[model samples]
Target: MEQYKKDFIDFMVSSNALKFGSFTLKSGRQSPFFMNAGSYITGSQLEQLGIYYAHAIHDNFGDDYDVLFGPAYKGIPLSVATSIAYSKLFNKEIKYSADRKEEKDHGADKGSLLGYSIKDGDRVVIIEDVTTSGKSIEETYPKIKAQETTPGGIKIVGEIVSLNRMEKSADSDKSALDSITEKYGFPARAIVSMKDVIEYLYKPDGSGLITNDIKKQMDDYYAQWGAIM
Candidate 1:
């Protein structure tokens, strides 16, 4: 595994963003582990989180893209943070854009989008905390596609998420990220995967964040809900 992947795992553990135990996911699956990006509340934590995301984005999608389109709510911060980090770390000025749950009725910027105005010929990369069943992308993808005035449309270069749970979707045997790539015709990637997390944290001597029992539970959970990948 790469150094950033290991450090990100440690960051997640230290920040309590990634937790092990019984938890019910939005996809209605009983998961042994869960990750909540919202746990990074402090300025320093958010800054570090942005650096990690910026690194992942640069590695996976490169800095050639124009816009970072984050979904409403949680993703709004992610987009802004990563855009700032991208500028600082890579010296690239990437625009940040996010959707609104409700459109503004009266304003100069009276539309569903916030931040950068997505226009024709812009290339967008969607950022998110995690993808479970891919319901969020389903809701936001159409809104993004509608922004294009020309026939070719604005290009969605790719998607970046903090973690890949490596679980199957509600209706498909493929993982949520994989489903998104197939559906949207663009690649979807994560900073680190569950496999990397297990490899780094699971110790047979029972001296790791993931103990023997917890590893067993994870194995069982994967057997039932793991993606075909």
Candidate 2:
């Protein structure tokens, strides 16, 4: 794992954003652990999160993409923070855009409200928090494709970098990044896996905030859901 990945997992475990317990996901399944990306609230924490994302982007997608398109809601801040980090760390000033749940009367009048106009044939990358059933990415990709001036014109890409990419049988385990990479050859990466995070927390000298019983409970809960990757 990368240094940032290790550091990020440790940070999240310490921050309590990566908690182990019975939690319900959008897929209507019980999860042993939960990664609440929205819990990263502080300015410094957001900056660090952006730094990690920028690292993942450079390592996976490199300089291939021209613009970063983050979907509505959770993706808004992710796009902004990541663009900022890319500009500062990599000296790459990539433009960022995002869609609104409801279309605005002004602006593009099409729905997107974050960045400026994305020209035809522009190489765009989609930014997201996590990949559950891939429903969100699937929905956003077509909307982006529709905005192109020419039919089958723009270079549409999906760059999904998340904290966890669970096994298919686990709760909300759909791997959008993996599927897209296999389908259209877009780059996919993650800071860390839930397994790695869990193992890290259990090591004798590892960074952990909870007790052994909590770890055991987490392990048992995860077992009920089956193997996780």
lDDT of 2 by residue, 1-229 (tens): 6778889887776676777778888877777677788888889888888888888888877878888888877887888889899999988888988877776777444555556557697888888877755556668877787788887677865475567545453223445455555555665557677667666667554346545767776666555543333
| 103-145 per-residue lDDT for model 1 (tens digits) | 8888898888999889889999999999999888889888898
lDDT of 2 at 213: 69
The segments of candidate 2 whose C-alpha lies over 4 angstroms from its true place after superposition are: 107-111, 169-176, 183-185, 204-229
Clashing pairs in 2: none
Would you estimate the TM-scores of all the predictions? Answer: 0.98, 0.84
List CA RMSD, all candidates: 0.9, 3.1
Q: Rate the local accuracy (lDDT) of all candidates.
A: 0.93, 0.71
Question: Which candidate number maximizes TM-score?
Answer: 1
TM-score of 2: 0.84
Total backbone collisions for each predicted model: 0, 0
- Residue 17, model 1, lDDT: 100
Ten-residue segment with the worst summed lDDT in candidate 1?
144-153
Locate the minimum summed-lDDT window of 10 residues in model 2. Answer: 165-174
